[model samples]
Structures are given as structure tokens and as C-alpha cells.
Target chain A: MELKVYVDRLSQPSRAIVIFCKVNKIDFEEVGIELLKGQHLTPEFKEINPMGKVPAIVVDGKFKLFESHAILIFLASAFPGVADHWYPADLYRRAEIHSILDWHHSNLRHGSSFTYFPFPHELCSDETNVFQLNASSAGFIQNTLLAPLFGRSLNPQAAAEAEKVLSSSLSKIEALWLKESGQFLLGSSQPSIADLCLVCEIMQLEFADETDRNRILGPHKKIQQWIEDTKSATKPHFDEVHQTLFAAKVKLQMQRK
Target chain B: MELKVYVDRLSQPSRAIVIFCKVNKIDFEEVGIELLKGQHLTPEFKEINPMGKVPAIVVDGKFKLFESHAILIFLASAFPGVADHWYPADLYRRAEIHSILDWHHSNLRHGSSFTYFPFPHELCSDETNVFQLNASSAGFIQNTLLAPLFGRSLNPQAAAEAEKVLSSSLSKIEALWLKESGQFLLGSSQPSIADLCLVCEIMQLEFADETDRNRILGPHKKIQQWIEDTKSATKPHFDEVHQTLFAAKVKLQMQRK
Candidate 1:
């Protein structure tokens, strides 16, 4: 039996895993957990991942793994001969990649919070539905959803605060981290899993209001170009996996119309 | 010539490196960076590490590496024969370690924020002196120093807030991650680098007020025992490297008296 990859395409990490598996041609079954529908909360999914988070995998029907970084490393190591570049063999280079991934959790990953908090109402059909959705879920409601933002209304100050955080995050990436890497981080010719993790994160900004997205990402040219370069390098796999996000955006636009 | 580890023992991650190197008997020269004196701000140190953080290593006096997680992994891979359990050979186990390290940055590691923000006054001798220290520095001041905390006064609300964050963090570790581990995470008889990282982080909470420390750590009996076990496992090396923090705490207590 092939490995089972449980993911919700709308989740950034999920998209990265799908892209990785597809680009590397790793044999796996893709199981979708729709976050919007609370499918991840189902007991069956809970049995697979007690954390109720996507981007989890069960390998060979035995070992269960969560955390996108771990999952990426597992896939890379398990299929080393095939997917060598996603994770490198060189000790120092691989360390740099590891450092980037670790640093990412607090830094660039803040983009997720900034993206959702600014425009939560727009993410769902209506405010009532958003609250009802949260009410139905047991335990904690997942972040980056509409419910958390309902406690605080959207205002200029909130937008500015989010922009400040998002911009600072992007600036650190541009100034501090990517100076060595011309096109990709750590100077890799091909995109690494770090690149996938970051691009997917920045892509979340697209789900934000257009004004906020441009304000936050507009000043950082290097980051914008790096995102494009990562996409171009990855090509069809990148586009294919991200279609869900694109579809959601189009649907939101139609709803507004 | 040996690998050079630049560190300030007061820093949690820096202490982890010192303990790791000493325990493993890795041939490395310990280069001290006096964070309290603004040594990290010097242009010379900046050339070595622009980020101005300690726990950086220069291998063979050439390739410079930063980020304690990266440095730990680099040491593990470079000297694999010496310390096997620190980072395991088993792919799944290593992946779990990676996940913990990555999860740490946002979860348990937020202890840094809670620790410093709660006790701003006792950290320095005087407010004027703290400003002078910051003004003299050419670069950013190191964390766990008196400067950043000096600006904010201690309050019950701050302590409560820190406790809330800290408690929520500890609960997740107890309920979710450590289900499989016997004494150490991942069920190893010996503690891994994940143990070093986490224990070092929790140790920082000790610097908080006794009341705050009890409130923060009191509920989690397993975590407290794990800390003791990790200390026992690491032993004299752990005590030796932590001397600086211990002294600082003593000084703070004396001042309060």
C-alpha cells in the first residue's frame, strides 16, 4: 500500500506537501480534509491525526507523522535518491535549510495571522455562519478562521498593525536571510522545501484584502521576485496544487459581485 | 585548531551548546560574547554573525554557522560517531525531533517573551544605566538582557498573561506530544537535543518571580520531573554552564532584599 497524505489544499503547508509529492513523483494517496467544512474535526480524521491538523501523513499504513517540516524531511530522507535537492546532502547547506525552517515558524509564518485577522468576514459566507461554525467545533477553533476575528472588528488600526507585522517579516527575509541565495534561499538553483513553505505562506496574503496585500508586500521587490522565481521553477506542480486557493478567491469575488 | 563556539552562557541556547559540546567531548574552543556588556553589538562580532546572536560556531575556523538548532544538527552530523542519541539514526524518531524543534520556536520558546516582559525592573541596576547600555550598543541588544525589560514595569496582569501563555503551552506538551516518550520525548532512555532545547527554555522561566514561576510551572508535574531528569542526565556540565544564570538570579534576589 502507498503512503497516505492527508491534506486540505487550502492550507499552505498542505499545498506545499502536495507540490512536493507531485514534483518528486512520490507514490502516495492524497486525502483531502476540507477545513471550511470542519471535515478535519471528524473522528475518522482524528484517528489518523489526533492533532486535527492537515499536512499529516501515515507512511506504509504504520508510522503517523505531522508537522509539514517533519513530513518534508521524512519524504526527503525516505526517498533520498530521487528527491535529493528538496533536502540537500551537504551537511552545512542542509543545516542552513534547517535553520531557515526553524526560524520560519515565528517569522514568515506570522503572515498567516496577519492575512486572516485583517479580513476574516470576507473569508466565509456570512458572520452568522462563521460563529455557527466555531460553535459546532469541539476543543479549540482553528486559527486563520473567521471566528477569532469576529471578536475584534476590522479597522484602520488593525489593518496597520497587521501590515506592520507582515512587512517586518518580509523585510527580514529580504535583508537578512536571502542575501546569499540569488534566486532561491541558500543559493539553490532549484527550489527547496523551504522555498515551497515560504511561497505558500506569502500566497496566503492573496487571500487578504487587495489593499492590505499590496501594502504589506509592495515594498519588498526581492521577496516578490523570489516568489515568482520559485513559482516559475516549480511550474505546473505549483499551479496545479494552488488551483484550490485560486478557485476560492474567484468564488469570493463572485460572492461580492 | 578546533571548531569555535561563540556563546554567552546566560543565553539558554548558548548554554545548551556548551552542555552538548562538553557532554559529547567535541573539540571546540568556547568564545564568550558578553551580552550584558554589549559585546554582541561590536562590528567585529557583527562580521562573524550579523544577527548578533550567540550559539554560533565556526568550523575549522572558516565556515560560520548560527541558529542553535542548526548548529546542534551540524555537530550531530559532523561528529555522528560521538553522539548518536542526541540526534538518532532512526528516520521517524529524527523527524519527531525535527518537529519538536520546529514546533518549539512558536510554542515553548515563547517563554522568552514571558520571562523578560514580566520582570523588567530587577534585571538592571537602574533605568538610566539601562538606557546608557542600549545607547552604547552599535547593534541590537541581546535578549535576556536588562534593557528591553527595563522599560516596562512589573505588574500582576503581566504575570497572569505570561502564565496563561505558558500554561497553555505546557498543557499541549503534556497532553499531545509526550504520550509515547518514557522519560524523554520519543521514549528514549537518554534525553535528546529536543530535551536540551525545551529544558533550557523552561529554565528561563525560573528567572521570573517565585510567585510567577510557581503559577506558570506548578500545574505540570510531568514537566517538572522531566526537567529534573534532564538535569540529572546532563549533570555537572548542565550546572557548570548555567552558573551565569544562577549568579544573575542570586544578584537579583540580593538586590530585592
Candidate 2:
């Protein structure tokens, strides 16, 4: 049996996997579990993933895997010919990739975590839980992550200096767009898992619509240009099949509304 | 240059890697990073690991790897003699192992996180991040993990009822502990990466003294018994190396007192 990816394009990890499969030409089946319908909470899905989260998969009827980073690494490991750069065999280069993956959960993951979705689970429940669904969580990120780090960022702001770097995380990315020397981050090398990660995270950030283009990704000159440039490179992958899935997802959201 | 393991035996992930190296018989030099001295926070080590965490390795003069589970999988992939069962060659089985590695972070790792030394940096400044190091961050596991599934675990009320199984998460493991059985967790198997993870997580529930013993791990039968048996089974890697580290760690705490 071929590989099967159980995904919802709405999920950042799921999008990463879809893009990876497209770029690498991996043939697999697609199974969508609607998050809004609470399908993930169902017992059947729980058997596949006790955590009841998405971006899970069933491989050859024998193994079930969760955690997007782990899955991405596994795919690259199993497919060697993808290129030496994607996951280099050399120690330091491999270590560099590993380092990025490691930093992700604590850093980039935090950025992704703060974005808000329109769920009422935390608020509707007891006051003690204090967990906000999606949007407020994004606000949580702005304060805990974007705000403080930005305040402490690149420029030595006389005041609010920290905030300048905050936007560039988004904008510096835009600056990279301006300097399209390489198809992916980490230079003209084959896009490593980091590229997949950035695409999802950037998409999620843009989804928030809070990012101001000019100062953030734009100010860097390269990142702003790179941001749009990277998206365009991957445009063909998301075209025929991805558009259908994306439209269907939008319809699903409207139905929820 | 040979591989170098930077470890403190008392740490969970550190012990897992140490045990893997011993069991696999991979040759390596040992270098200690003094956790008590706060060596990890130093500028020099930061270059080695930006995360400033334990159980890191510098492999073959170049690769520096952190995150114990990731290291464990890498070792399995890098070393030829290590049984495939530990990591598994089949895609799905590997995925199952990967799932646990990921889930363990929120489940088993969460359980383990609750059992910290509760150390703080400043009685002088009264900066109470230490006091605020609430085990409560891990309370979700009690409600979600132990109460429903494991039953009687660390529950003060059921402390006596489920004492045996509750103590070690290994009462059933008694059957698996026999010498002649020879196999490890999966079957008459040496052990898979899954076993490595469990060994690491279980070790974290250990405490320093009699008072601590009464607190949780000591009072419970299954838990205590499991700790004893497993530690005995893996004696060489720990009692020799980890015990030394553990003693020094205790001494450091006593000095603080």
C-alpha cells in the first residue's frame, strides 16, 4: 500500500506535508478529517492518534504516526535521492537542520500557537482553564512572543526598539522574497524541512492579517520579496488539486458560519 | 575524533542516551556539562546548544545533537548493529515509534516534568520564578492521563487501592522482568526505541530521599517496585555513571541548603 496522509489543509503541518509530497512526487492517498465537525475527537480517529490532533497518518497498515516534524524527517530519511542538501548526510549540515527543527517547537511553534481561531472551548468552560481558543491565543503570542522579542530585536530602539524586529520576522521574511537567489531559505540549496515549516508558519501569520507588509518582511528588502517569491514557486503545487481542497475548506468554514 | 556525550545521569534524556550507547556499545568519549554550576547557560556552551538543555552530543567532531528522543532515533539510524526493532525498518512500525516519541512529550514527558527538584535561583532577590515553577503546568496530565486511563495514579485518595500499579506504571511489567524471557518490552526482543523512551521517562519519577520517597514514588508499590527492577536491569549504565552524577547533584543541593 502507498503512503497515506490524513490531513486538513487548514493545518500548518498538513500543508507542509502536502507541499512536500507535491515537490518530491510522492504518491499517496489523501484522507480529510474535518476539524470543525469534531471528527478528530471521535473514537476511531483516537485509535489512530490518542492525542486526537491532526497531521497524523497510517503507513502500510502497521504504523500510525503523529507530530508533523517527526513525519517530515521520516519522509526525508526514507527518500534518499531527494538530494544531499534536503537532509545532508554530513554531520554539521545534518546538525544544522536538526537545530532548526529543535528550535521550532519552542520558538516558531510559539508564534503559530498564538494565532486565534474561533473556538469557544476555553471561554465557555470554567474561568480557571483560562485558555482562549484561537484569536486571543494569537494575542497571547503578540504579547509573550512577538512583543517582547520584537522589543528586544535587531535595532537598538531608543524606545520600543524591541518591537522593530518583531515585524521583520514577518518582514525580514519579505526581505528574503526580494533576494530570490535561492528557491528556499538556507540558500539555493534544495529546500530543507525548514522551508516547509516557514511556508506553513507564514501562511498562518498571513491568515491572521495582522502583519503590516512594508515594515516587517518589506523593510529587509530581501524578506518581503522572498515571502511572495517563495509562494509563487509553490503555486503550481497548490493549483489543481490544492485549489479544490482549499475551496472545499472555505465552503466548510462558511457552513460553520 | 570520537563521539562525545555531554550528560548528567540524573537527567531523564541523558540516561536514555547513555544506556543506548552502552547497550549498542558505540565507542565515545564522555564529557560532563555541570548542570548545578549552570554550565549550560554559559556563552561557550550556548554555541554548542542554543537551547541550553541536557543530553547533548558532539558526534565525530562536527554534529551536535540535542533533544534526547531525536538523538535516540539518530543513534539507531547511525549505528549498524543496533537491532532494527528498536527503530524498525518498516514504514508503519517506524511511524508507531515516532508517534510515541512525539506523544510522550505531552503525556509521559508532562508526567515527568511535574517531578522537578523545584530549584530556584534567588532567595536573595526573591525573584520567584522558581516558586512559580508550578507543577500545576502538568496538572492537565493528571486529569487527562492518569485519572481516566492509568487509574489510581498519584491520586491521594486511591493511593492505597492502586498502590502497586500506580507506583511504577510497571506492575504488569513483572511478567516481562523475568531473566529467562530475555526479550524486552515488545517481545523476546532486545528493545526498540520505544523501550528507550519508556526507560528514560520512568527514571524521572525517582527522588532523592526518604521524605521524597513518601511523597509519591516511594509510597507506591508498583511504582517503587518497577523503579527497583528496572534500575537493576539497567544497572551498569546508571549505578556506575548515573549514580555518581546523582550523588554529586544531591551534594550540590545540600550545599545550597
Top model number, lDDT? 1
What CAPRI grade goes to candidate 1?
Answer: acceptable
Over the stretch A38-64, how does candidate 2's per-residue lDDT look in tens digits? Answer: 676679877776556777777787567
Tens digits of lDDT, candidate 1, A1-257: 36899987777888888888888888889998876676666799778776566778998888888888888988988875555678998887898888787666754564334433223322321111111222111101123233344463334443444455557778877877678756888767778889988888778666655765676678889899999998888788898888988887777555445
Model 2 docking grade:
incorrect
In model 1, how large is the Cα lDDT of residue B216? 68
Candidate 2 global Cα RMSD: 9.2
- How well does candidate 1 reproduce the true complex, by DockQ? 0.38
Per-model C-alpha lDDT, please?
0.68, 0.53
Q: What share of the true interface contacts does candidate 2 keep?
A: 0.29
Q: What proportion of the real contacts between chains A and B does each prediction keep?
A: 0.71, 0.29
